[model samples]
Each structure stands twice: as C-alpha cells, then as structure tokens.
Target chain A: MEEWLRGLRGMILESLARHGLPFPVGRDVCTGWAEGLGLARGGRRILYTSCMYQLYPYVKSVTGLLESLGVHRGGLRARMAARGGSLARFLARPSGRDVERSKAILRSIVSLLRRGGVEVGYLYEEEPYSGALLYELGLEDDFARHAGMVVEALAGRGVEEVVTVDPHTHHVLTRVYPNYVEVPFKVRSWLELAKPTHANRRVKVAVHDSCLYARFLGMYHAYRGLLDAVGIERVEDPYVTGKDTSMCCGGPIEAVAPDLSRSVAELRLRRLSALSRTIVVVCPICLANLSRAAVDVEVLDLAEVLG
Target chain B: MSWAEAFQRASENAIPRTGMVLEAYRYVVSWARELRKVKEEVIRDLDRYVEEAMSSLRAVGAKPYLARGAEEAREIVGDIVGKGKLVVMSKSMTAAEVGLRQHLEGLGNEVWETDLGELLIQLAGDQPSHIIAPALHMTREDVARLLRERLGADVPDDADHATLASVAARFLRDKFLRADVGITGANALAADSGALVVVENEGNARLTMTLPRVHIAIVGMEKIVPTFQHAVMQAAVQAAYAGLFPPTYMSITAGPSSTSDIERKRVSPAQGPGELHVVLLDNGRSRAARDKELWEALLCVRCGRCAFHCPTYMAAGPRFGAAPYAGPVGVMWAAVTRGVEGAGNASLLCLHSGGCREVCPMDIDIPRIIQRVKSRYVGRLLRTG
Candidate 1:
C-alpha cells in the first residue's frame, strides 16, 4: 500500500511540476491520504480507481494478479484484467457512455458483495457521480431507487461497507441519500488513507489546507498531525482556514479574478515564512499556485516526506 | 460597479507620486510565483483535501448556509443584533469586508470596538487601514496626541506600545464588564462540531467574547472547516504565514458558556457570556466561489502575513491601501468586497514576486488572480478608447 501510494504521489508531483506547480514532500502526501481514507489500521484490501497513466507502475502487481486469475495476458491486458472484468474494453472504447457504464459496473460489484454477506470494509467512491446519480439526472424521486440498487448490489456481493474519498460524493451519500444512511461512511482524501512509514531528514514543510478542508470540509488538524508524525518539524502558510473564511487558491476562479489569485498567493507566502524554508503541501492546486510564485524554498508533496 | 469604473475612481483618488498602486501589483505577482514553486505537489492533491475537509466539517454538526450577496449578509447580522445594546466588538476584517460595524452603528446600537488598534482608529475617526494591525500607519506620537485629546491630561507624551496598550485596556475594561453584547470574528469555524476558533495575541478578544451576556460571532460562510483537527493545522499555518511561532492565544468556542457542574442544573461562569449567537455572512463570497479566477481570493485565512512580507507595504508604511485590508490581498479585496473605486488602485503597484504564495497554506495563485483583475481594468481602458 505504501509503495503504491509513493508511486501515486510521484505521478501527481510529476504532473503538477510539468504544469509549473510547486513540488511536494512525499510523506506529507502519504500521511494525509492515509488519514483521510481511514487506512491507518495496517491491514486492508485497498482498491484504486485506475487510469492508464496512474496504473502504469503497478504492471508487475497487475500481471501477478492476472496470472492468479488464470489469464495469460501481458502488460496492458494484464493491467486491465486486474482492475476487474470489462474495464479494459471500456477504456479502449473511450466514450461518455462507456464512462457511465464502467461506473455502473463498479457500483454493481460493490452491491453484489454487500448482498453476499462478505462484510466489505469500505468503498472509496470518486466524484460527479455516486449515490446522487438520481439527483444529477433531475429525478429526485428516483433517488431511493438508485440508492437501493447500489446498496443491494454491494450487499449481494458480500460487501457490507462503502466509503467515498470525494466530499461531494460523501455529502450526497450520507446527507442526500436515504438508503445510504444505514451504511457507515468515511469520506476522506487518498493521502489520509495511505500513511507513510518513513520520514524526511532536515526538511522544511508548508501545508496548504485545501479550501474544502478549511472552509467546507474541516479536517485541517488531521493533515497537520500526519505531517508532524512524518518528521516534518515545520508547517507554514495559513491564508486558508475555518469554513468559509479560507481562500480559493485560484482553481475555478482562474478565468475571472486572476489578480485575486496573486493576492491570495502573496497572503499565503507571508504566512509560510514563519514555518520552514521548505514547503510540504498536501493539495495539488496549491502546489500549482506556489509553483508560479517562483520562490527559493523547496516545495514537495507529502508523499515525498518518507523514504 | 464594473471593475474598470472602480479602478479609475481608485486611481484618481490615490495619493499622487506614491507608486504604491503599481508596486503592490508587482509584489503580489512576485510572491505568488514564489509560493507556486514550493507547493507544486499540493496543487495536485487539492481536490482530495477539499473532500476530506468538507466531510469532517459536516461530521461536527454544523449546517452549511450559502449567502448570495451583501444584502444577505446584512440580513444575517440583522437577525443576530435585533434590538441589542452596549455591544463590544473585537477587530475582524470579515466584518469590515461587509461593512458590518458601520451598518450596526448606523442602526443605533452604540457599538464599541474593543481591540486597541480598532479603538485607536475609532478615536482618530478614521477607517482601519490594515487587517491585523488596524492602525499600522499611526506612530506613537500620533496615538499619544489622539489619546490626550480624547481622554485628557493623564495620557503621557512619548507613550510606548506597552503604555498605550495599558491605557486602552484600562478604558475598555469597564465596557467589557458592562456591555450587554459582544461581537467577534473567527479564525476558523469547524463544521463537524460547530467549533469557532479565534487566534489572538491580546486578551481583548477573549474578554469580549466571554464577558458579555450575549456573544455574537460574525464569520464569513466560507470560514467553515470539517473538524477541530483541521482547524488546529490551519491555525498553525495562519500563525506561520503571519510570521508568528504560534499565535499568542487560541480559543475554540463550541457554543454559549455553560457548565453542568451545578446541582441538577447548568451554571454559566461569571466571566463567560451566557448566550452565544453566530452570524455567518456570505457577502460577495458566493459569486467569488463561482468565479474561477477570483474564488481563490476567498480562501485567505486572514493571517496578515502577506503584508508583512511585502516590500512595498513596508516601505509605504501602511498607508498603501484602503481601510481594513492594506496589503496585496487588501488591494484585490478592496476591489471585490469594497467597490474598486477607493482601494483598488493599490493593485497597480504589485511586482509579482510570488513570495506570498510560498507562505500561503491554501496556495492561492494571487499573481494570476491579480493579473486577471488588472486585465479587466485594461480591457475597460480599451473599451473607452
């Protein structure tokens, strides 16, 4: 799990850097995701949502899993098979409908296990679509029906629990859906779910509390605790805090109020000067914002905190 | 008003030959660029972190309320202040952002600003020029004369910070004890448990919130966080950003001061307020939230670190921008929260160092946001041409 998390962090960092974002400390990223996912227990079967770019490094692991499944496929085929049945075909087809169908398949798998009395631990759902599919479709009355379909499918497959890493999904499942109320839900970040065991030496760290974390979400301290445990002695930068009091970090607002973005960044840098010379950020867009700042401090993802 | 009209008005009203307007813009851009370089990875993990934060806030038993505009915020504040008197308030830029204090005072409540900086500004009959350091532009001589003029002879000439502080403390102590109501701003609000976090160096905020019979906390709707743990981290980030090792004090308020220690009943402490009312103000934030470029400005945690790090701000000596928010963020905030007319010209001075971004906990791309706003100003110039 740690290895996969490291790889994932590296992939994200590389992508962000390519886009001119700040670099992140690996361990901070790992701990944040670990805590978010509630995976600190040390024993759990964690399944990752895969894209070809993300699953590339796990080729050997996928190949082994596929071989165990009696499939002699190599490379890409093996990787696809390991994700589950029919995922490869969907990926190859590449259409909006295909994306929808793929989500349905995953949901079906979750429901099937729940029904089979398998006592599934958690389901990490992503964004835009979850149990709130009915709401999105403007069929609010069918919410119960759609929710039941998901629940029964997970239960039928012997999966007893479901969790979502996306707050929007969690909000819909826990707050919006009726059938989902019975299911124990833990909504968190991928970093919180994958805590790193190693710590970085002589490193300065800065944490960017995502707007959702500071304004909408409220898991600010958990992210801090995770960074502290990873041997990151300093955490700086505070312009984002509380519920609605936090700054937007120039994501959706990039198209309109670009000057406000600079102002927000300037505000954040003033806060960071007190913590450490290096910044260890937890969020991706923050990294992007900091990267454009072009300061002297070293910026790293939380995942890079550990060896 | 349109960004162009506001910019023109502000530029025209600005103190000539200061160059603060252009310098502020350059500094913000430079600071933002520096922050971007350091927090690259965090930008990628933004979506995940936001999810975690929102979930935690909900778990703590807080309700999410969206405000569409300034009118909505006024309504929320109106509900909380209904027929109240002898109100004592701690300094909060959020209140200033929506002009809550003036609005309340206009309603005839006799509001007293308890923070020394705020009080000094009130005495001087001027608006706050900075967020944290409200009277940053004033010198000891200026304060001494002002105090002497208002409070009379006993006030010393050459009064130092400590002496001035004591004088302010002595004057406000009675008000703290006698005030019927208290108003304050939150550093962070945990949504999961409904915890309001306030960080301060002075004990005034503590006294203000606890001493009054009815305590009112006016926070922006975006101040919500998911949990206490996240609030702690965010506070640390705020302190660091502001160049403080740790904020001198931290207060986590869940609700009204209550104790179940009494016999078969709850008893409130003598010092703590009995009733707590929270007023969540939206005031231009919903539009900011939806605005791709400007929304990032809403993520500011109010640490005031950006102003401290800004070279132009330091050189300009605090008269750099409009009241309540006086740095790079202040310039932009003035444009968005206030009309662009009076304070928006400060953005023209920013140098775009990206240093401010390096220290931001949320890593908002301040320079880019500033550029976007400026581009609009430029666009207006062309439209008129």
Candidate 2:
C-alpha cells in the first residue's frame, strides 16, 4: 500500500512539474475541448480555477497506474483489504473516465458563468494541485510546501480571483491554503458565482452534500438556491438529507483504507437510495464515490442537471 | 461486523432523541455560548474548585478523598467500603477507568451495576459501546439471551423493552436494598455549596446514590463548577445536550442526609445514607488542565450527543470509541487520561464532518482534537498509516 501511494504521488508530482498541469489530465481529450474557450496565458483580473477541475482524466491516470501495479478496478480494495475477502465493491476512486465527466461538469458551469455575463478566463496548464489530499493525509510539511508552490503558480500567472468548480478545490484554495501559505487570490465555488437564469429543468433529484461543501464551506444553501432557480424538484429525505445532518461521501478515506471507504459510502448510499431515483451532487468527490455506490439509482452532478 | 445494520438501528433511535435536544437548545437562547463561558471559567480554576468542593463537603460531615490516579482511586474506594460489603454502583466512567467492579469482586465484595444499559452489558460481559447508552450495541434479543444465561430467568428470546426493563429492575431492586454501599458518578461538582450534582433520566443513579447505608460518589476533578447556580445551569445544558429535558431526576447530593426537624438539633442520619464519602479523582486531569489545547476537552459534560451524530460512530459503534469513553469526546478523554495509543485508529476514522462540534453543547471542537490525536500517532510512527 505504501509503495503504491508513493509511486502514485511521484507520478502526480512529475506530471505537475513537467506538463505544467496540476492533475494527470488526458492530453488528447482536453486539447479540442480547450479550443472553444481559447484559453490565454495572462488572466490577471478574473481566473476561474479548480484544484480537481481536471479530476476525470486525473482519476483515470491513477487507475491506470494502479492496474500497472497488478491492482485493477474492483480488485484494488480487495487485494488491500483481503482479511476475510468476503465483500465485493466497485472502485469509486477518481479515474481518467471520471475526469472526462468532470470536464463536462466544468464545461457546463463555465458556460453558465458566461451566460451570467461574467467574462471568466482560464489558467490552462498553469493551475497547480491544491494539496488537499496531502493535508487530509496528515502530511503537513508536504502540504505546506505544495500549497506555496500552487500559490506561486497562480500568482505567476497574474491571477487575482479564483472561481472553483468543486468544493474540495474551493475549500483547499480558500480555507486550507491561507492556513500555511500566503494566498493572495480571492476564491469562491463556481456554484456561488453562476446565476440561475435558465428555464426550469423540471427534474426531481436528491441532493447529497459532501462534507466539505455542506459543513465546512457552508455552501449547501448556494446549491439549493441554484437548484430552486433552475426549477428542479428536490425530494428531501429527512432521514439522510439535510444541511449538517447529511452523511459524508467517504472519498477522503480512499487513500487510507478503500474497504472502509466503501463501507462508509455504502452506508450513505442506502439512506440516499430511499430518497430519490436521481441523486444530484455539487462536489466531484461526492459524484465519484456516490455514483459508484448507486447501483439502483442514477447520480448526477449539479452542473449536469443545471443551467 | 455490519456497519450498516448498527448505523440504521443507532440512527433510528438517535435521530428523534437528537431532535429533542436540538429543540431544547433552540428554546434555551445562547445555551452553548453561556455554557462555554461558565465551563471555561470553571475548568481554568479547577484546582480551586476542587479544594472548595472538598472543604465544603467536609464541613457538611462528608469525608472527601482525593486520588492521584486510577490505582489510587480504586484503593481509596476499597479502603472506605472495606471487604465483603455489597456495593451497588451506577454508570460512572471514572469508576470504569480503574476496573472498580472487578477490583471489588476480587476482594470478595459483590458489586452490581444498577443502570439498565450497564446491567445488560455487565450480564453479557461487554464494555459500553456508547457512554450514555452503554448497551447500544446489543439488540433486544441479545439482552434477553444474556439475562437468561446470567440470571436463570424466564426471559423469552423476543422479549419487549418493557419486559427486559422489568426483569433488570426486579433483579436490581433487591441489590439496591441489600447493598451496604452505593456509588455514583457526578455530572457536576459545585464548589460554593459543595454539592455533587448528578443528572439522569433513569432512576438508577438516584437509587444507587441514596439507598445504601454508605454513599461513595466518585467524579473526575474536572466536573467541578463554581457555585450552585453554575451547577444548575451546567445541568440544564448537559441535559439538553443529552436529549433529556433537564433530566427526570437531578440528584444534588451535598452531604450525608441531615435532619434539623427535631427541635433544630441537626441530627445527621436521616432516610438517606448515614455516612457519605466524595471521591474526587484527578487521574491525569491536572495534566490535561495544564495543556492549553487539550484543556477544553475536560469541559465535556459527557452528554454522548456527539457520538450519536458522529458518522464513524453511527456506522461502527464500539469500533469508533476509545476504551472507557466512546465517540468523539471519548477519543479525547481516552487520549488525555489514558494516552494516544488507546485512541488508536478510531481517531483517524473521523471524517472532519464537524457534525459533533456543531451539536456539542460545550463546543469542544472534537474533530480538531481527533486530528491532534492523529498527529501524535503520526509523529511517533513517522507515517499516517
């Protein structure tokens, strides 16, 4: 497990330094996708960024690396958590395919912001990883150093304000970064930015707030405000759905213990399953973990179902 | 073994109980803020409060004993109660720390846990999974099975909660009457009037503290409040946090039962215990007092609400708790009193949801405390693993 994590960490760090990309995002997938926006190098006034913005392909790269180490999808946690080896589960960890879906989510949010009359610019290939995983893993030194590097990269690109795609990135850049490093950029989750001008979608979705967004960031209301304006029908489950009462998606423990992560996710999924057939989420981490756990239900990103 | 099964059962019980507590918080304006202020003041001057409590209780003809640690605490209790005396005790985390029941039983004294949950777990030979609701891990069927084996009773496999309680009560009522000594844990120790205030929904604590010829109330030194009014307020907040409406029974036991009704003569022995012994156990609390960051942990009223709301605890039950203490608060208590290793991997399971901290009446910042415990392990092991 240690060797696997170490190798994964090295791969991510190497990709960030060499490619000038925070995540191991797919080069081919992002190339044509980047053409419409026509991303420029200098974005001084407003820069819409995300720590895990390139999450879909980055997750894919992680899965590929793990497979190379003889740990395939579904088999990843089994080999590591093979005590009784009775339980079987889907791999909810971020993968390259998840990065593709994440890209779509980001694209919709960017488009929504554009329609909201905000001229948002992207710092393509310049944005660095926010070291959220490092902080969560209790690697304070690495996190502090990585935070400084990320801040430096953003500052070097002359970016002042950051509109984040997901709460994990939003939380890290805004809250965690200032704790250790000097963060000069103004930050907000894109949900906090995008105006709900589009007509009602008329869809019923059960919203699951990831721990960071709901509790720490206090952005649960922001999502609700958007959903309400978008005219989506919200099916509230008093048992499992609410502001602080909602359960965690268990994505954070994926690095430490995948089986435990699966257990946590499964527990949360059961509560959510009773609520709605379609579960909508704001955080990419939540989308990945809950989507994998939703065997009998469909999980949608907030962006996927929104304006 | 089944995290989902336990999570479902525990949450089903916890959700409504939590609502009651939240409503209490809502009605009692600034409950958390006011309590935090009072608790902070009391905990900072814990030594003075401890001294004041001892001096005042002593004046009331109750002998107050101080023990440095768990070993000393057990020895002190043993000395007072003596050998071959029936001892009936309520659920007290302080007593559990030193394995008091086992120590007394080793010396040939019969010790019975009077609290229903504690009694069930005791019969089953199990440690408490939750501090407030100790037998939370055991289902009704499990309790029935344990009772049948332990007490040779006609307990059916599918006995209802009322039936189970009746059996436990019938068994404990005799012990309460026959016992020579009654022991309890105080929620708060008021220094001004030297009152040991313990609040409980079950009548067991009241029975355990009052019925016997001798009463020994054991509490951590951190339980002390400044005055009677402060004790009253503390009880209110503690009850609200514990999902009770200021508790069904609030036992404010100042000293041995006294009577001045006979021509103002101040005769000591009344209906209650003739002799009273208040054991204020330090047991690493002073060390916690000196530490700046860890000091607020001592302010915990042990309401057990934090555990109920905690996801890891809900899923895993006892697996999420430290020994002698359960849930997020338990993690802190076990770390401070016992050490970091006892907290073990359970502290790491905390997802930093901040749910526990939000509902915490004292507002102890439990997730951060868990992080601190995790850091200690990380520092020692040189890895997050």
Number of the top lDDT candidate: 2
User: What lDDT tens digits, residue by residue, belong to model 2 across residues B100-156?
Assistant: 888888888999999999888778788888778887778788878888999987989
lDDT of 2 by residue, A1-307 (tens): 3443444445445555655443444333333345577556557644444445455444433433333434312355435533212111222344556666766777787778777776677656445556776667655666688889888877887788777777777777777788788888788667766876763356687888877877777776888888888688888865577665786777665545555555667778778877787888887677666675668888888887876
For all candidates in order, the CA lDDT equals: 0.51, 0.73
Give the per-residue lDDT of model 1 (tens digit) for B96-213: 6667777788777778888888888888888775667677667677888888898663667777878877887888888888888788988776655667888888888898888887
**What DockQ, between 0 and 1, does each candidate earn?**
0.01, 0.40
Pairing residues by index, what is the TM-score of model 1? 0.47
TM-score winner among the candidates? 2
- Clashing residue pairs for model 2: A56-A98, A56-A99, A57-A99, A59-A94, A59-A95, A59-A96, A60-A95, A60-A96
Which stretches in model 2 have alpha-carbon errors above 4 Å? A1-35, A45-53, A56-97, A199-201, B1-3, B21-32, B383-385
